[model samples]
Target: MTPLDSSWLAARPLPQPDGDIDKNSRGRVLVAGGSETVPAALRLTGEAAFRAGAGKVQLATVERAALALGLTMPEAATFPLPANDAGELGAAAGSVLAGYLDRCDTLVLGPGMGAEAAATAILSAVIGEPRKGLSLVIDAAALGACADMPNAVRAHEGRVVLTPHPGEMAQLMQRDKSRPEDDPEALACEAAERFGATVLLKGAQTWIACPNQPVLRFAGGGPGLATGGSGDVLAGIIGGLLSRGTPPRTAAAWGVWLHGEAGRRCAEQIGQLGFLGRELLPHIPRLMASQR
Candidate 1:
């Protein structure tokens, strides 16, 4: 494993144009996730996607949380799904969500989604579908749910990007729990090849690998990013880039780099010790400009 250093930071690709036009031309992103306890995940992701230049962001989540998110971010569109008695999305909502899938340029899954029969069923339907125009970014809890679905991975015709932390990667690969400091790149590369999808394994030196290409490592992120909701923000950024028509590999690469850079910038302002994940969101546009 290569240690994160200046050389690794220099390897990241510079930022490119935000997109060809204004918000309408940027592309649409559909963010699906959020259980009762973690209602904030979907909102955080939608905000991050918008900050990353997505033209429009639609969120499909449990009904109760949907109202709050809609009111908070009126720019975002919300679709409330029927929830079970426990206030979590139920299996029956999958068919209802299928209609909206066709409208999005990219799909972002697993931010704050809780484990329940209903959420799993919805995820299965989304993953099992054979949509060609949309891109998919799978992260967090969704990673664990779909890790065993080899057929689902094989069947996906759209661009698929998997973002996993060390523990999540181990779960996906069925390996022992290993720290990101412990050869994460090799393990990530293996998982990417096995699933035939691009993998972004998050850690000190984030590793990005595709089925046949050499693994690319990003080293600029700071320890300030070691907080909850950080991965959710990264997933949203990946979704935003995908919606803008960037390829999975390029989007993952740039998203990871920009996320880390934004965290670093936020740390400088607020100091790393107490910086929150949401605090980093506002800095993304400035970070993008710096990269350009």
Candidate 2:
């Protein structure tokens, strides 16, 4: 396993900023996941995408929460999608989102999405269609959706990244979640090969695996990053990097480092465990810049 640290990150440089470029040049990120129960999930993801230097970020969520989510985040362009009485997105969401996919450089799927039929439907609609320029960051409920659609995920090949915790990873790999993972890196690699995509298996020590490549590991960030919405931030960071046209494996690796370091910094500033996920955002750009 390769160590995912500052030295490794420095060697794999990110796209440098161009003074003459506009927002469109940096890249656009579309975050499509949210419900009434977890409406603010999109805010954390979208804002983190922006913090990671994505020029533009948009939020597509259930109709009920769109207006208020928009009010909280004026930076994102919001789209209200059809949803059920419980505020989960409806099947039509994926179809509606298809219209917006081409406009975004990357799509961050499934954050704060609760268990619902819409999750599978949306995943099917999005993966069923081919959007060449659009990369995917699959997380949360969408990770579960991926299990039922492995071939669909493989259809995207190298353009997709899966961000799942051990429980979610177990689901994707069809492992018994009740049992402990014997080897996290091995499991991550198996999932990566199975799905034909980069897999970041999140834990206290994160592991990133890509098909036919060396696995990378990061054991920093401490318990502070174990909080809610933390994975959403990491997913957004990866999505933002993918928007900048970084390769799936490279983006996943860099994002893990940035996220861990940001968590470390937040722990230093706001105590090790109480720091909010949003608190990790401001440190991203600075971390990237420091890598330069």
Candidate 3:
């Protein structure tokens, strides 16, 4: 296994945008799915994408939350998706989001989105679209759908990445949640091969497994990163990297390092624990710049 550390990152650095590059050239990330229950999910995600150097971001969520989310985060263009009476984005949201696939470089799905069926429907719709060059970073409730729709994910081939903690991993593999994962790397590799996508199995020491490649482990980021909304930030960072034209495996590896290192920095300045996930945002750009 390769250790994803500062030295490893320095040797294989991220691509730098040209000085004359425009926002469109840097790429656009469409972050879909949020709910009133987790109002900060989309904001934390969208802002982290910008911090990671995505040129633009668009937030698409249920209509009830769109205007307020837009007002709070003016940097992103917000789209009000169709919502059910219960306020969750439903299956119909798929068609609306499908229309935007052509223009999006990466789609970050299932951040704070509480409805599994809705996310699955949207994922199916998005995958069914015939667009090319768009990648995906699937997280949270969406991971369950991904497990059910392996064929849909394979349709995207190498352009997909799944970020799941142990619990989500259990759901993806249909393993008993109460049973301990004796070998996390084995489980990650199994999932990666089964889904034909890069799997970033999150933990104190993250294991990133891509089909046909050796597992890469990132052992930093500290326990502080276990805070709520932290996974959303990591998803956005990977989305931003993919939007910038980095391949899925590389993006997952680099994003894990960036997220972990930012958490480490947060621990130093704000203490090892109790640092909010939002506090990790500002550190991303500084960390990326230092890499250059």
Candidate 4:
């Protein structure tokens, strides 16, 4: 496994804006559904996207969470879609989402979403139908939806990136709990090839793999990254970079490194164990700015 470090960043530097460009010209990101109860997950993601250089950020969530998110994050435009009694996004919202698909450069699916039956239907509809110019970052409860069909995300055909922890990865592969594919490098590569999407298997040491490319390993987040919702931030950061027009593989790799750096910095400031996932938000652009 190769380390993702400054040398790697130097070798494959991030893209820089050329000339006069408006915020719209830079990038626009759409975050689709997290749990109605904890829209913070999706909110964290959209904020991270903005920090990662996305010019515009939008959120499409359930009715209740929709209003809260709009009030909390004024920078993003929020849409409230139909929700079930359990407060999860419903299948009926698919048509509403289709109308916004063309407007975003990248889509972040499944953050705080609880694995409700409706979630699977929504995921199936969205992931089953891939968009030509859109990039997808699939994480959290959405991974459960992927578990139902081994090849459903394959429809994305290299345009999607799946960020899953070990448990979720097992579900995606339908592997036994023993986790025969627990080795980050092998699991990341295998998932990428089998699902036809870039894979970032999150762990103490994260690994990213894309088809036909060597595995990229990043090893430096402290225990701080162990906190809940961190994966949401990671997904958002990666999605944001993708929205900025970074290629899938590059965006995943860069996102992993930037995420780790942000975690380490946050840990250093607040002590290793007490930092919140939202704490990582403020450090993201600072880390990304230094990298660029």
Candidate 5:
């Protein structure tokens, strides 16, 4: 396949600032993921959502992480799920989650959720159901959870966006191969067509592809973003955009752009080596404001 060209970049338009009174019209976003090992994922995603313009951000996590997240970011609401002896979300947690799915405009799954069986079950339930009005963004562990559940993506009634690194894409494609560093765009487009959803394949040049839309490459982000938790931050931004009534392709395209811009801003200040995901939080609003 020929490498995806750069022409798709011009297709997306920057978001216009809402009138002062209409600013509150921004949507609600729910971030579900967090386990004993990686409790910070939920907080990272929730904060990023708020920064990206979600009017409200809620997080669903295991009991232990809930207290810390709630205390740390009092702006975000928390829903604690029942965990088994292993400290993982149990299958019953899905029933609890289903009740809140209706309240959120978008659902962002699998930030820091570990690979425990109970967590897998909860993710499976969330993806299996038909979420009619909600948009879903599957990232990190959630992408891995769906490796054998390609049909789950097909069955979902809502808009779905998948953000994965090359390794994760390999697993999703069920292929034991490495990403052709030469053409990340082509690989992402193939995966998006196969999965029937918008695909954001992350790398030096993040590439986004949707079933009907042309492949888009965002070349703005820098190496500063290669750190951990950055992907969760990107996922949260996408969730926020989806909540704001942006189409899946538009949200993915803009989210990737904003994320890279944020990383670039951070690199300018922190010299690229020590910039943390949390640091990128403050830059989101500035970046969005610049779009105007």
Candidate 6:
């Protein structure tokens, strides 16, 4: 595993575009998640992507949240898909998503997506199709969708990233004999190799790994990051960076640092227990400016 020293963090840079450039010149991000039950999940994810520096961000969710989501976020557009009888997205969403997948530089999947057959079908359809030059950040229920199909995203190689917490990690690697509880670093590495993508095993110390790349771990975040929507924020951060032309490894490295650092700051400001998930959004710009 790599230490991810300060020198490396300072030296390895992100894209720096001119002030007059449009959103596309900076990066385009599309977040696809949310069902009838939890519209806020997709909205929060999209907000984090924008705060993290994606110039243009679009969010796709079930029809139940379309009008509300669009009204809440004017800077980013929202598209609504047909919902199934279960009040969740289904495989039919893949048809509408095809056009979106073609347009965005990166896609963030799974937030507020319940573990249901509909979610599984929707994710499976999206995974079965091949993508070119597009990056994917899989989180939440999408991890479960592809759990049984280890090769679901393997064809995409380094273009994909899977963010899973301990429980989610167990779900994702259910068929494997190794217990993720024993060694997170090994689990991350093996999962990355298995999926042919980057894997971030989230915890107090997030372990990031990809095939042929040195493992990077960040142990900065406090218990403040244990909140519900915090992982959604993380998925957005990494997805946002990937949209802006950052490689999966570098993006994961910086994303984890930014997230952990923000959580650390949040904990300090609010006595370790009062910070809300939305509070993390404002901290992102501060961190970016300091890094710049």
Residue pairs in collision within model 2: none
Best by lDDT: 2
Q: Looking at model 4, report the run of 10 residues with the lowest lDDT sum.
A: 176-185
lDDT of 5: 0.79
lDDT of 5 by residue, 1-292 (tens): 2123223434455454466734346788999877877877888888888888888899998887788888888988899987767776767877788778988989998788766736567767787778777889998767876667767786763288999888888777776656636567777887777767898888887788887676776767788899988988999999988888888888888788778888988999988778998888899888777655
lDDT of 1 at 43: 79
Residue 239 shift from truth in candidate 4, angstroms? 0.8
Lowest summed lDDT across 10 adjacent residues in model 1 is found at 1-10
Top candidate when judged by TM-score against the true structure: 2
> Which stretches of candidate 4 lie above 4 Å from their native place?
150-152, 180-182
Question: For model 6, how does the per-residue alpha-carbon lDDT over 1-292 read when each residue is reduced to its tens digit?
Answer: 7766455678888777777888886888999888888888877789889988898999998988888989988988899887888777777887787678877889998888876526676767777777887898999988887777777688776789899988888888884434776889988888888888899998878898999988987777888889878988989998889988899988888888888888878888886887888788889878877886
Cα misplacement distance, residue 184 of candidate 5 (Å): 2.9
The candidate, 2 or 4, that scores higher on TM-score is 2
- Candidate 5 differs from the real structure by a C-alpha RMSD in angstroms, to one decimal, of 2.8
Q: Weakest 10 consecutive residues, lDDT, candidate 6?
A: 115-124
Q: Assess each prediction's global lDDT (C-alpha) against the native.
A: 0.80, 0.90, 0.88, 0.83, 0.79, 0.84
Error of 5 at 217 (Å): 1.2
Per-residue lDDT over 1-292 for candidate 4, one digit per residue giving the tens place of the 0 to 100 score: 6788878877777777668987877888999886667776778888889888898999998887888888999999999878888888888876777678888989888887886727677777676677888889988878867776657777777889989888888888888755724466887788888888898888888888888988888888877889888888888899889988888989998898888888888878889888888888888877777866
**Candidate 2 per-residue C-alpha lDDT over 1-292 given as tens digits, one digit per residue, 9 for 90 to 100:** 9999888888889887778998988999999999988998999999989988899999999989999999999999999989986789988888998888888999999998988738888988888975788899999988888897888898886799999898898888878994326789888888888889999999888999999999999999899889999998999999999999888899999999999999999988889889999999999999988988
Residues 1-292, model 3: lDDT tens digits = 9888778778777878888999988989999988767756899999999999899999999888899999989999999888766677788999998888777899998898885337778888888753568899999988988878887787787789999999999999888874326789989998998889999999988999999999999989999999998999999999999999988998999899999999999999989999999999999999988887
Q: What TM-score, computed on C-alpha atoms, does each candidate reach?
A: 0.89, 0.97, 0.97, 0.95, 0.90, 0.94
TM for candidate 5 is 0.90
Per-prediction CA RMSD (Å): 2.8, 1.1, 1.3, 1.6, 2.8, 1.8
Q: How close is candidate 6 to the true structure, as a TM-score?
A: 0.94
Candidate 3 clash pair list: none
Q: Which parts of model 2 are misplaced by more than 4 Å? A: 178-180
Count: clashes, candidate 2: 0
